[model samples]
Target: MTESTHAPLLTVRGLTRRVGTRHLFDIAELVFRRATAVALTGVNGAGKSTLLRMIAGLEPAPGATVTWTEADGTPRTTPLTPLPQALRRQVAYMHQHPYLFRTSVRDNIAYGLRARGLPHDEINRRVGAALGWAGIVHVQDTAPDKLSGGEIQRVALARAKVLEPELLLLDEPTSSLDGHAREQVIALISELAAEGRCVVMVCHDRELINLPGVVRWKLGEGQLDTKHR
Candidate 1:
């Protein structure tokens, strides 16, 4: 991964999650910088996925303080209750088993652009580029049901990449894939980081964990052990 001289894109303080009366995890502070890739690791039920969900605004953490720093050095901090649309647009989250629309791969990739009401030409341009970028152009017209696991994952990545998010959150992106398929996803991930996007993934795969320049953060015993390389 190329080193980034830019400021951190997102920071969180006092991040905590609980289940009933039991605490799942507590993170004092977490920082994510552009052009960086982080692998969050821990044993089962360590709340790794939960943390990513909270950051993506898909889960609630009532008292957590989340701050998003813009490219212009402006900082916007807010409680974790209601995330602003601006922040939401800057961060994209992909589940391990991504849920694709019951439509063609190209149409699925165009979903986000259409939702934002972009011009027809712009959506087409971006979708086309994204399809090629993810190397799934061969399956562009295929239905999700007809594609393999690797193809589906690549389609999901294209769907997220077309929006050009600054921060990408992935949960077990390469789980249960064949050797060639896994390599393809990992290469795409590296390319994403190289392009100056911050990527944080919940992963246990040694290949992903030991990826060059990847920082590993371990979550256990209700605390987060952060290590930067």
Candidate 2:
């Protein structure tokens, strides 16, 4: 593998999925070359969340191929829906209302790093950085059940940030927050994309969709269309 100035980091070819008896979407030849945020939107029940989960490497579909091009131009292929465990760690999926553990904010943010078997000192160091990233350092000691909805979302963001995933899948991140909280999350989403992370968000917010470097896509009629935005 050698470094290439122009090469997509990932490619999905001949992708298809079945939701019960109906086909989920028609996707073919999709490339993720830019670090900009990709905003997916459609009517309710359009399987927006479903698509994100699949791309995050959940249940796999046969005949669907997902290939990733490394920084050095090496290409690795796998079933898009069921990425290998190690590759899966490079992708993080966050729910509309992400679940928080029954522990302090610090612990929640440290979960992924700890799960990866990092030393205690390293985990602590990363957790502190994550808290700062999400602007939740002040609430590092707060329990999940005790925090407000906005705070919980921030904590969840911090937890996900700690993993340093290349692909961040967000399911309606700002749906349950107030105006101010929504702004905060939006800002962070933009920041993540600008920092060279591939961010795909399921959001209906007009403002969020129009953020700088955001590419928009519509999901409906049982198809996923790229290069149409």
Candidate 3:
């Protein structure tokens, strides 16, 4: 972890996860500061995704507190209240492969806003902005499967970005893209962090994580290493 030891916006304490005979994470404690960019890197099967899933509440992690700051500004180590439903909207988790709904790219990004009860014009405006930000404006009407790998990833990112979630959990978002595409995605991630949304990305590329001011965490040997500058 970085020596600064600042108060964390997202705190994970005594987190433990077990699958059969293997202990995925053992009482792991880490914190993610608000609006910061944190890169998680490790070899295959290193529990990176599992850890992210735990934070997103997709899987159960016992003996831990996923705490958020109270209105009064006091720190509390409490399991989130009203659980899954509330967390789902607050946390946006994007997988390595973008999941397209077999619909048009516009519809895919619009789905998130519509779910939040946004009006048609408002949804259109947000989708347009997201598409432009993701650099997929040219493919706005194409079927997701028909788009190139980079385009698909951009659309996936657009879906998550349009939601404007508090936290974004990404899984190797640039792994399948070419060099230029990867740079574009990385830039977008940097911009998101600059905009004050906490972004946790699972990426193994050293260069990619070296984006200005990003913190690095290595997951290996059944544990999350301290954050590295």
- Estimate the TM-score of every prediction: 0.96, 0.92, 0.89
Residue clash pairs of candidate 1: none
Overall local distance difference test of candidate 1? 0.89
Mind sharing the TM-score for model 1? Answer: 0.96
Top of the candidates by TM-score: 1
CA error at residue 32 for candidate 2, angstroms: 2.1
Quote the positional error of residue 132 for candidate 2 in Å. Answer: 1.1
224 in model 1: Cα distance from truth in Å?
Answer: 0.9
Model 2 clash pairs are none
Please give the lDDT score at residue 173 for candidate 3: 86
Number of clashes found in candidate 3: 2
Across residues 116-198, which tens digit of lDDT does each residue of candidate 1 receive?
A: 99999999999999999999999999999999999999999899999999999999999868789999999999899988899
* Location of the lowest summed lDDT over 10 successive residues in candidate 2: 1-10
> lDDT, candidate 2, residue 69?
67
Which candidate, 2 or 3, would have the higher TM-score against the true structure? Answer: 2
Residue 6 lDDT in candidate 1: 67
Better of 1 and 3 by TM-score: 1
lDDT of 3 by residue, 91-164 (tens): 88999997899989999999979878999889999999998899888888899779888788888888999998
The stretch of ten residues in a row with the least summed lDDT in candidate 1 is 1-10
Give me the candidate number with maximum lDDT.
1
Ranking by TM-score: 1, 2, 3
